[model samples]
Target: MDFKLTEEQQMLQETAARLVRDAYGFEQREAFCQRETGFSAEFWQQLAELGLTSVPFAEQYGGFAGGGVETLLIMTELGRGLCLEPYLPSVIHAGGLIEQLGSEAQKEALLPRVAAGELQLAVALEEAQSHYQLHDVLTRAEAVEGGWRLNGRKSVVIAGHSAGLILVSARTDGQQHDESGISLFLIDPKSDGVRSRSFPTMDGRKACELYLEDAFVSGAALLGEVGQALPALRYQQGRAVAAQCAEAVGSMEAACTFTLDYLKTRQQFGQVIGKFQALQHRMVDMRIELDQATSMAMLAACVADQPDSVERSRALAAAKFIIVRAARFIADQGIQLHGGIGLTWEYMLSHHAKHLLMVARQFGDDDHHLQAFSALLDVA
Candidate 1:
């Protein structure tokens, strides 16, 4: 079977790329990122108008029903422009969680609104201990009179402060690291006793430290069964990482393109530096690595929505390894080739570099994926 994008997918890619390239141009991104909101509400609303927020959902919920492939396509373009939006966390992660694990009623209640960009959300699943391991949750969810009460702090909750809702992972019957009794819950961020404090990140993304003390949520808020959501959560995370790989691919490709263009223009000893045979080889190598990384990321994107656990983990980890390694190499070479200008804000190289760094480490970096790869392979 062919691996190329379908006509619709191509349209999605072109549409998203054009919109960001034109509307969220480099200057606009800088201005928007420096704002207090930390993202562009107008841009996000435009995405919603374009049905991007609804891409991965079904038509019944006003979504185009685009799958993980669509998300990857959109995210890659988003990375190229470094658009300051919370599409991944607010739309992809939160919406995916609701669709895959929420009850039918819950989906009907939350997803349609999310697809419309009416309710911004974040997945507050990462605690101090929830690093790389979904089932390693320490947050406890105890049954109370009207609902469940949460009492743990979630660290590094991306965009948590701006979210209207949060999907919290909690342990009901399981010990700190046990798989049994691990559960996912939906909580209103505006509810009593649920507080979030924002932290500015290196690359301008806003994360939060969430204090969920007596954070009450209804039983209807439980996503999937109490003990059965761990694997699903992990699966969603793999898809998220797959999207990140695509984003990294785009960022690295842009950096490579930027470096190549600079080399072609910057003169050394009265001749363009790109005229050198050695420099030509280096550019070609960077191009090769970027293309390969993008191809691997596309492969992972294609397989991310698969329900088979083994395949999902392997594909995501493999793509991550290829993409992360290539991204680092290409980015470093780009910076070196560009000389000091690469590090200066007057150029876009530094912006792309920071975004690439965050994406490289986001879900799981090289070391994290290496562990996952070993676990999937059953090797020591």
Candidate 2:
């Protein structure tokens, strides 16, 4: 199959790259992380003004109707900059769910504002015990007077502290771990009975632990149909895994670049470290891992928006597994090559390494995806 980017894709990639390069300098990123929101509000507005926020939605909602490739391009640039914005959680993951599962009225009410960046969103599907299992929902949503009362806790909600709305998953019926009874709800984070404890993640992004004690949402807040959100959740998460792989590739690229630069300039006993045969071999291994990661990222992007099927799921699992392993290798090797300077807070390489490490933990870890891929294998 052809692997060339279309002219429009190329333009989108360049626009995203230039925007990130100009706006996300190392010191500037540090300042952004210091803010209460843990990201640059001005840069978020820039994304809205430049229409980058609308890249994935339908045109009727003031978006480009772009798909996986477009998302990959934007996320790669974001990753390279070590940006702390909640683009993956807010725009890609939550917004895509609304587009896929929301009713016409829900869409008409929410999509435009989200696309315009007037509102931010987050997903709250993970429980403390769920690990990466989307179907292991224990949060309960019981039918009430005019809506539902939610009761349970959501853990590690990325950007949940600042989101205007949170798309939450709860067990509306059936037993825990059963796939048939899960449901989705759109909840106002500031509503009564909702509490959040916010903190900074290792990668400098903000996240929160959400507690819902009799948190009531109106009937209109339900997304898709009751007791049937698992399929869509799995599919959208597959897309997210694809986007994340691309982001990892970008971080790996930055890490590799920093290591190579350090080897060339840092003097050793008598010469630059780049001249050392042993170090040169290590650098070559880092590059090889990066190239393999890039290829897997591309493969993931290609299938990210495809119709759901066993093949699509298997491909995504394989891509994520490979990318995760590669990211860990590159992160370790990058820091090793940089020596003491790599661990310093002032260096961008250290930050990139942290981001790479965090990427391995999100969505599903390397071992998780490896098991998933193994389960999907054809054994005929």
Taking all chains together, each candidate's TM-score versus the true structure is 0.96, 0.99
- Which 10 successive residues of model 1 have the least lDDT summed? 126-135
Estimate candidate 1's alpha-carbon lDDT, on a 0 to 1 scale: 0.84
Please, what is the whole-model Cα lDDT of each candidate in the order they appear?
Answer: 0.84, 0.92
Off by over 4 Å in 2: 378-380
In model 1, residue pairs whose N, Cα or C atoms come closer than 3 Å (at least 3 residues apart or on different chains), thus clashing, are none
lDDT of 1 by residue, 1-380 (tens): 68788999999999999888889877887888777778888988999888788888899877997877898899999888877788888787878888888888888888899999888989887778667777788888999988798899888888887888888889988688888888888888889979888987767778899998988888888899877788778878877887788778778878988998998899999999999998899999999998899888888888988885676778788889888888888878888888899999878988888777777777878888988898889942
- On TM-score, the candidate that comes out on top is 2
Q: Please identify model 1 stretches exceeding 4 Å from their true place.
A: none
